[model samples]
Target: MAELQFREAIKQAIDEEMESDENVFIMGEEVAEYNGAYKVTEGLLDKYGFRRVIDTPISELGFAGIGVGAAMNGLRPIVEFMTFNFAVLAADQIINHASKARYMLGGQVSTPIVFRGANASAGQLGATHSVAYDSMYAMFPGLKVIYTSEPEDAKGLLKSAIRDDDPVLFMESEQMYGLKGEVTEEEDFTIPIGKGKIKREGDDVTVVATGKMYHIAQNAAKELAKDGVECEIIDPRTIKPLDIEMIIESIKKTNRCVVVDESHPFGGLASEVGFLIQREAFDYLDAPVQRVTLPDVNAPFSKPLFDLWLPDAKNVVEAVNTVTYRK
Candidate 1:
């Protein structure tokens, strides 16, 4: 294993995939000439050249449709959105074409594409730039959504997504690009989609988190540990084909659950998890499932207001305390 930043791990995965498959190519704004909005594609243009690591104009719809066409014609395309907020403009291609092409064409075409970019809050980006649209995208039938938290998971899952036959919505965090963690140096490491990992094991309560919120859950678990509240933290690395079984197993063990997600409270990942828990493991639950999520309103521009608006360790700890009956 080698210590690598989250962005570095992603770069390695894309580089390795492009090296292995001639059909695999990456395209998006600033990807080729400017590296990437987050620099995840830094040095990739030089390594892969302009033909493979192509850059497009600032037209999400136009380029996204081009990617769908490429995927339909046998190429595997990785379309980076800069941020998923811009993906709204490409909804027609993503939802109507890229996702439904196989079914629409009676299996004559396959959209082996990965639409990836930063998600959720990234330090005062305001409402337009800070939405976590994973749950919304998960509503579509053909798309596989992944919200990775760590460097290792990011690398492995990205490699898998690039190779998958279906369209995958790969969401990252602008805040976590520089976070460092140990990642495997293997040339072909891949993590299965729809698998969750238990980051911390404890019997007191189960905390399910994804993406940036997973880090908050870890910090909250540590603080709760000091207070004699042993919290088990599970990262549902993939959001759409959620690893509900892992979460159910952890919930069965702990008998209490607190789901944390960066999305809005209504129709968020936490809501889906909470609903699934009650349905699949209701008898095992000792208390009602709690959720920690962003407020229902738009993301605030003010620092203090944004801090209050976004979900954090404090919110998680409080939810855990309430479920544990320590409040």
Candidate 2:
């Protein structure tokens, strides 16, 4: 195992995949001469040259369409949007074209493309920039959504996403780029998609979270532990092809559940997970499943307001308490 920052792990994944496959290439704004918006592709341009490490005009729709076309022609392209909020401009290409091409054509064509970059609120970025599109993209078929929390999971899952023969929306956080964690140095390390991991084990309650919310759940779990309210934490690395079975099993053991999602409450990941838990593990549950999520309101630009709007450890703890029937 090797300790690396979250951004470094992502860079390593891209570097390894590109090294192994000549057809693999990455393109986006500031990805070449500017060394990427977050420096995730810092040295890749020099390592792979301009042909493979490309920089494009500030047009998400244009470059994203090019990436889809490239993938259709047998080139595996990694398209990076400076921020996923900007990706709305390319939704037609991603959702309509890349996602439908394979099924519509009956497997005759495969869009092996990866669209990735920072996601959700990074700190008072405001309403338009703070939206979490994970659930929205996951609702569609033929598209894979992977939102990673840890460095190791990011590296492993990203490598798998690059090699996957479908359109993958890889979500990351701008705030988590500096987080450090141990990642395996094994050759071709890849974590399977749609597999949820038990991040912290406990028997009192099951807490499901992903992306930035996973860390908040972790902190809540620690706090809950102090009062003998053991909270088990599950991180569903892939939002699509969700590892709901694993979550059901956990709820069976704990008999209580609390889901924390950074997205809005309406039709969010927590909503889906809550519904599934009730359907599959209803007999085993001791109390109603609870959720901690951003209220159905646009993100505010004010720092203090943003802090209030964002779900935190306290919010998760309260949800856990509700589910566990703790006073």
The CA lDDT at 158 in model 1 is 97
Q: Count the backbone clashes (under 3 Å) in each candidate.
A: 0, 0
Candidate lDDT (C-alpha), each = 0.94, 0.94
Residue pairs whose backbone atoms clash in candidate 1: none
Q: Judged by lDDT against the true structure, how good is candidate 2?
A: 0.94
Global Cα lDDT for candidate 1: 0.94
For 1-327, candidate 2 gives per-residue lDDT tens digits of: 899999999999999999999999999999999999999999998899999999999999999999999999999999999999999999999999999999999889999999999999899778999989999999999999999999999999999999999999999988999999999999889999889899899999999999989999999889889999988899999999899999998987999998899999899998999898888989999999898999989999999889999999999888877877764
Error of 2 at 118 (Å): 0.7
Weakest ten-residue segment in model 2 by summed lDDT: 318-327
lDDT of 1 by residue, 294-326 (tens): 888998899999889988899999999999999
TM agreement with the true structure for every prediction? 0.99, 0.99
**Model 1 stretches astray by more than 4 angstroms:** none
